[model samples]
Target: MKSSRIQSFAAGVLIANSAPHLATAVTGRQHLTPLAGRGSGPKVNAVWAALNLVGGTLLLRASRRGGTERWDGDLIAFETGCLAFASWMAGSERWLRTNTARQE
Candidate 1:
């Protein structure tokens, strides 16, 4: 049960995380990534996005092994993870902006 919840949460986090990168890739925008670091190109972003999507899909499948029996709980956990990631991203952006402003 715990494993399933964890997997669902991770899947949600990864899936949500991939959306921006994929959008950047499609729009030909450069984005920083852990893999390639600063100024990563669209091609690299595309690949990174795909990897995240695949990983998330796999985790989702693993978590869904329980079928529809306990899907409500799984969905809640997944949404919570997504929300957590969103909060982190927002906070990171604010932190970066503040630090950048301070440095100038």
Candidate 2:
């Protein structure tokens, strides 16, 4: 049960991480994704998004294995927590760098 819950939570994190990058890629925008290096562009972002989708799908499948068929509160909480942290970090990195650059 505990292992299943952990896998489910991990799946949630990957799914959440995938969504924004996919959206940005589909929209043909160059947004800051995890894989986007300093020279990020539309094509790079799109590739990054594809990787996220693949990873998320794999984790989702893994979560479904080992007799885990339903969602649990702990699973949900862990997923949500990871998603929120990822979002915050992604959103803040650029702003932080820009602000610090100006201050220098």
Candidate 3:
């Protein structure tokens, strides 16, 4: 019983931490800017977004494999950070695309 409880708690924590990453992934897919008229800004943002996506995917896989027994706070924090960054990048890309489209 105790072990199960602990497992549940760890899973909960992991899920909570990973939620932002999942959200970011969705946002990234939805808000990707076009390749055209990217200028310098979109290129930079794309790099960041790609990094974030990669990081998030890696962390998610780690979390799944690690499970409750191997849960690490640092990993969770890193994942959360990556997710937040990804979301910001996605938003930026979307904005740039919209503005560029309007100008053209």
Candidate 4:
């Protein structure tokens, strides 16, 4: 049990550290762009929005299965993060659309 707890702790730490890279990868893939290449902001934002929705769903499911009473904080954080990402994506898309309209 102790070893398992330690492993779980390590896993969490690793996940936290790797989140930025994962986010970038997901953003890139959603935009259909190379990881090292520049992608349209709107496209990336849309991808992020989609990913956040999906991630939020998954997190909620996990929370439910794990018993939310025990991990309420994590669940709340996940939900908040998803909302933040989605909102940012929406803003990005709106900005891009407006910019394009201006150019036209």
Question: 1-104, model 3: which lDDT tens digit per residue?
Answer: 33433333444444443444344344443223233333324344455446545554554554455356564664545445545555665686577653334554
TM-score of 3: 0.30
Once superposed on the true structure, which residue ranges of model 2 sit more than 4 Å away at CA?
Answer: 34-36, 73-82, 90-104
Which pairs of residues collide in model 1? none
**Per-residue lDDT of 77 in model 1:** 85
Q: For this target, which candidate reaches the highest TM-score against the unseen true structure?
A: 1
How well is each residue in 19-83 modelled by candidate 2, as lDDT tens digits?
A: 65667667765566556555456677677767766776676566667553565564674577467
lDDT of 4 by residue, 15-72 (tens): 3323433554555532322322344354554544455445545544544553435653
Clashes of 1: 0
Task: Flag the better candidate by TM-score, 2 or 3.
Answer: 2
> What digit string (tens of lDDT, one per residue) describes model 1 on residues 60-88?
89998757766877898889888988788
For each candidate in the order shown, give its overall lDDT on alpha carbons: 0.83, 0.63, 0.46, 0.44
Q: Write down the RMSD of all candidates, one decimal each.
A: 2.8, 3.9, 10.0, 9.7
Worst 10 residues of 2 by lDDT: 95-104
What are the models' TM-scores?
Answer: 0.86, 0.64, 0.30, 0.35
